[model samples]
Target: PAGRFGAKTGGRAGSKPGRPGAAPGARSGGQGGRPKPPGAKAFGRERFGQDLGPVRAPKPKRAGRPADEIDVHNPEGVRLQKIMALAGVASRRVCEEMILDGRVEVDGNIVTELGVRVDPEQVAIHVDGIRLQLNEHLKYYVFNKPRGVVSTMEDPEGRRCISDFLKNKDKSERLFHVGRLDAETEGLLLLTNDGELTNRLTHPSYEVPKTYLVQVRGPMAQGVGAQMKEGIELEDGLAQVDSFKLVDSTPGHILVEVVLHSGRNRVVRRLFDAVGHPVERLVRTQVGPIRIGDQRQGSIRVLGRQEVGHLLASVGL
Candidate 1:
């Protein structure tokens, strides 16, 4: 490498045969008998006021942009709980409990670590070798709950519920309802393991807007919407409807659209009862950033990403 440094040689390959000038490599001889070294301590480089070939450096590595930076194809983005939930195993919280209980294993090793990150597609996560993380593609399903089905995952008495309705549903992953609905109500229900969004929507602190369409046993009247809007006192204290408008009405029945920030159990029914018009049938027509929009009962549809983003933005999630 030192010899390859062109600074030692003249512009030509070798030194002149018999000249007073310096040789190519050795810079002729010392000052006592010949020209001094071009850059020796004894004779400074400015002594001749000339520059030789540069210190060769293998072309300086071309001085270009970097390679092997971020690998976009890396598959280590999914959280462990999410992976298990999406594998049709259980809910995220249940998955965490299993992991902590030492029931789940990843790569044949029982991984009890919480919040572990792994490649869902590449790594095999198993609970008793039952293969988790197989269907973990961040799935979402909206179910139109019918009456008589409990809104939760399971019941203590084992009554016929929504979970039964979803028994033969798309076996993509272990999904659960976003919020809850009373057994006598029929309405929109979202199911997914997107815990962050679920927390925002379900937590009463969020006060997310929920829209309900109620068929009440009453006559169409001008003051009914006003009475519902002015607020009414229930066992849970006073609750107010964000908006209440008459949809269609008859002498014995009235269909009214009611929007509220409360997801209380039987909230729509209770609100109507507080106004002296107990609801005969309560059906949720819309949820925060979601709606039925002609979706039939017991049917399911995947929510779009933009819809999810809008929901997040709506609640400042």
Candidate 2:
């Protein structure tokens, strides 16, 4: 009698019942006739009448990496913000904000995620479109070298040298002068622990332009700037300045700005000497993108990130 009644009710024999003509083994509610397992976790929204808390929007998907960009992901590498902070880009917090603001890029892909990791040595990183120098060991400085100071790090003759101005710096890291200025010449001299950058900056083939403020005796000269630009013959060979302009002229002395890409020994002095205007005082004001500005003589200042970036970019680094 029970089996025949089950067929009339559309339920399996001995099944619990409420609805007549319901499908066999189907539950009255939406539980599909199966009980939840013991100790099973329940989601908040799944429990009816519970508060769902604040709803969060999904994050936008990142764009695909360019075809030219290599994969920079490194599971064991340091975090992106940590690397940026270590590279002197900014504090870790600020770097995180910069990353979120889309101002940072790794291997040409704009990285906005703070959790991204990168190998500092293998990846190319840029912040605000400026290449970042990631090597912590490398140091760059602009030294306002004083007159009579030898360009060498140490002078054997006991004269003032570049090292004398850097007594407070870490003695372990050897800093090399990018280029030399004779004992009599002075101005902005680059000091760096990066050997590759030093070589590139000093190598004559790179043609990194240097600007100098030259004081020379000038009374009668009509075409001196043009003559120097045209090319002046010296002892070694013909030398020329990229541009020459007279800045100021007094009774017996004149201040001239000379820009040239030559790294020849005393090239500026020799060029002025060839034209009968011996250099009274020679001070290099600029080297590539770095400048002396108002930096006092015999003092050193570390190069800023943007300055270092421009300096490296100038040499195709």
Candidate 3:
């Protein structure tokens, strides 16, 4: 008789004792019965009866900030991208791309991750290897100073000066000229509220270069350029041009360009005068990286971001 132990008396060899006609040690809720626990080491069988290896708990999701996120250096300060955009590096979106591309550096470290925060006044930021000016209050400009205008912001004699052209500016800004161009000299001049940069630029140690276009009585002597390059004895000290080139030559006037690192007063006029070709008309064309290209006379233009960066770099700022 078949009992609850599955026909123990007449069960076939190796048959389990679960139920009548049970085959080969089969149990009610064993391998072919209930679903296995997720952590079970038991092999699973696919619908097609293919053997599937032990089920593994889905790899615990990695715990931490994602790769794209950066640790905020200054939680309360402005975002790096925002500051970069304000500093005129580019549009906000473009600045983000630049940061991700690793073209930006904060305090000398290449910053690739986004969401970085910094105090514009505290940290030194650079883009494309050029120092960025982050101070919104510090203004820089290139004024196309016309002839007979004194370089002083205000002249005591009441002559036309830089201040006349700056009447439209905010009175509280307190901007000052970086260096100076004499009353008779005309062309590019830098005006800024950045005192440290101004001092370094004007200092003799930095040797910030200045370029000028000089119109002199023509038929210049053969060795004038060479002699100027060699050195010219000025009332103050020896002065020399870093570069000199004859641009145009006519019957009575010769147009020449000279570049020098001397910031001495009236140095260009004195150099040509010493060489026997007194400057008939003098126009300063460049100061460091800033240029007066096509800028109309007596007009003021804000210095571009790249120009300011280059100017800062020229004096090792």
Candidate 4:
């Protein structure tokens, strides 16, 4: 009756030399042991040749050290708020609001704490259950926009949109115009996903240099270039050109290259027009280290890494 330890069915009901079923109040050989934990299996259930069948449940979620708790593993990591901002999903100021609203999470757990440092690329970050892809390729573009299309991302007036050009081109990432060009104006426009760089360059206090070609309707007085370089008083205040040169001059028409660091609302046109020579056409030719560079109208080109670095350095970024 006590012959076999673990005997299969189709055998004698009592314990025997070849087979034996468990006696009442007795346990199977390994049945009394702990139940198989999640994600523990042997070879899994094999199906067809190619189909390996379902996988075991994943191991329990890992609980790592806090992001901003100063762990040696995350030396270069920053707070989650800063990390999210760096990813270009939103600005730091806006991210703080989202965090407080309980819309932000780390590793699928709601993280309401501020000053949490996170390595954006490595950390599992989510906003309202949508996992964010943080390491997407950063893109920088210089567009030579022609007249007619609206400078903004979209226009409610149903006018042609410049963003349409990038609609199908970039799907995973978002691009924003670094600085806006007026609907009538045409020329170089910097585009990028780096919010910090964009905000810095666009801020008036940075005083990044920009150049434009202005076409006046009538001939100017003698020493007009000097007059522009010295500055002209507008209704707002005095405005000066960093440099002005006569590209061409003739009766009823004149072309001049004007450079300035302080950009205002159509200041170039207003300044020339203030001098009794209202500009008939104005095209911005350059900004910081970027130039129009033979880029045709409505064309987008990715700026080279070296060019991006040069521009950043020029602005002391």
Candidate 5:
């Protein structure tokens, strides 16, 4: 290892001892000619102008829009839970539970408190990490169906359906009937896309009330209302009216008002027919707080906010 770095091997014949650059062996293997293979030396701070330290991965791009990008200053808004309920995510009470469980979010921030208010028109909302589409223009309509028109949006046989009346409405929201009525029955049918409200109105657990006006024929049976209230056995199951009354009567026809919570198909007609009377005409008069009022046949109108409010209140939504 004596001349490992091309140090002079003492003065050679006619050689400049201190100047290894002048040696042929040094030119071939030492610093005089061939480079030290560049990075053969250990790295040092002087290698570069500045200390970059250790390389790191780039900061991850933010997951979503930043909080500052959201308008926290929205002045007019409704309770966050109520907004979720209206969005059909859940009932307001259940939405509160979801919030408390950190499953609800507004503008990317998990909101656990029930008191948070949100301008749904301005803010983004989410539930269980999925973005929620808040229908700012929530729609509720009551259609006064006419006889011979189906209660559905379409019929394969070209029979007139409820869409005939709603197709020309100003709004374009897709609507569904809360429950079905046969082609011969009509009136006070609800059309809405409010899923939570619809569920409560139609679900058996809620027992939301429904009222019907029926025209029947045949001799009046004694204590018919009382007998019907006690329940009658039908092909599907037992059916009964919550309340029934004879509104008016002629020699051969009688008008009766019946209220019940069952959503059984054709239950009213079957109930009356079982008691010696057959229904000639049927019209739904009310569903919960909604009524046909004087709404003309084949007409439709958006429900008022107060009416919607009353309906939600009745169902604890």
Candidate 6:
């Protein structure tokens, strides 16, 4: 193989003088030196629009942070218990129990952690294998409860109750009375399935005032309004009217408007009873910013958006 080109080509195999087939400096087909490291050729393959074999295995996931720790800066979702309650599944406390009991599912997987957040708008939720209908389209109504109607949905005593009125009304979603008026009392009562609004309205810290129009036996006492305004200590606690105004007056009966913020059972009747003017007829005229507004007795109507908004705003909801 020692030839004229071999001396000038040096020791390298491809450094020989050029010629057909076996040129001294020319290499054919075979690449020189060592091969590339595995998968290194795939680099820039995507840039050239070539198939670089199956894409390189995904980069290994980083490991450092604890799994149990939640990132407060970026929350995953709404709390499972809260969203369930909002969906009218149950009360918040009951929802928590349902979750702990392993009767709740998210995205077809059973989720028992109460802390787990779920995107209610995106995820499918179920309870006890039954799909839950989210109360996304919340409903708020003003029902003018008539006399002899119990405030509750059902009574073991088999008395007439709010369910009777709701029987003919809309049944799209479960609705609850925000507050109660006894069977003998009647007027504007709020009915809604909006858990947040209901919570804020019913919470004691909000001090949402309720107004009542009462027909009571009067004309004997002159300073009755002042006495009721001060306060009347009941067995449970101090019950007081925020303001008292006389709407009409007669010897036999007088119509007065009483405003109070207490939610104690039958507090209104107790207040009038303490004042020595027994209430002949008690009708709740308003709660917060909502009023009966001449809605005939036993008639139910959906509240206007503005009315609902104002009612919520009054309680800082």
Order of candidates by TM-score, top first? 3, 2, 5, 6, 4, 1
lDDT of 6 by residue, 164-257 (tens): 7775445546888898888899898899988888888888999999999999876758888888899888888787899999999886889999
Q: For model 1, how does the per-residue alpha-carbon lDDT over 51-76 read when each residue is reduced to its tens digit?
A: 44334334322232222222221334
TM-score for each predicted model, relative to the true structure: 0.56, 0.71, 0.75, 0.57, 0.60, 0.57
Ranking by lDDT: 3, 2, 5, 6, 4, 1
CA lDDT, candidate 5, residue 51: 28
lDDT (Cα, tens digit) per residue for candidate 2, span 178-291: 888898988898889989899999888889999999998868479988999999788899899999888998998889998999999999989988889888899999999888
Predicted structure with the largest TM-score when compared to the true one? 3
Give all candidate RMSDs, comma-separated: 16.1, 14.6, 15.3, 17.4, 24.0, 18.1
lDDT of 3 by residue, 1-317 (tens): 23433433434323444566655534432444544566765343322133455567774532444433544367767889999988778899999889888899888878876667888898888888899988888899899999999988778899999888885654467888888888899999898899999899989899888899999998887998899999978889899999999999999999999999988889899988898888899999999888899999999999888898988888877
Clashing pairs in 5: none
| Candidate closer to the true structure by lDDT (higher is better), 1 or 4 | 4
Off by over 4 Å in 2: 1-70, 85-115
Q: Which regions of candidate 4 fall more than 4 Å away from where they truly are?
A: 1-136
Question: Alpha carbon lDDT of residue 93, candidate 4?
Answer: 84
lDDT per model vs. reference = 0.68, 0.80, 0.81, 0.71, 0.75, 0.74
Query: How much is the lDDT of residue 129 in candidate 2?
Result: 77
Candidate 5 lDDT, 1-317, residue by residue in tens:
22434553333323334354455524322334333333343121222322234445465532444333444424367888888888677788888778778797677677766656678877767677555655556678889999999877878999998788876553367787888889899888988888887888888988989999999884687889998999998999889999998899899888999999999888999998899888999999999988899998999887765576577667765
In model 4, residue pairs whose N, Cα or C atoms come closer than 3 Å (at least 3 residues apart or on different chains), thus clashing, are: 78-117, 78-118, 79-116, 79-117, 80-116
- Give the per-residue Cα lDDT of candidate 2 at 62: 61
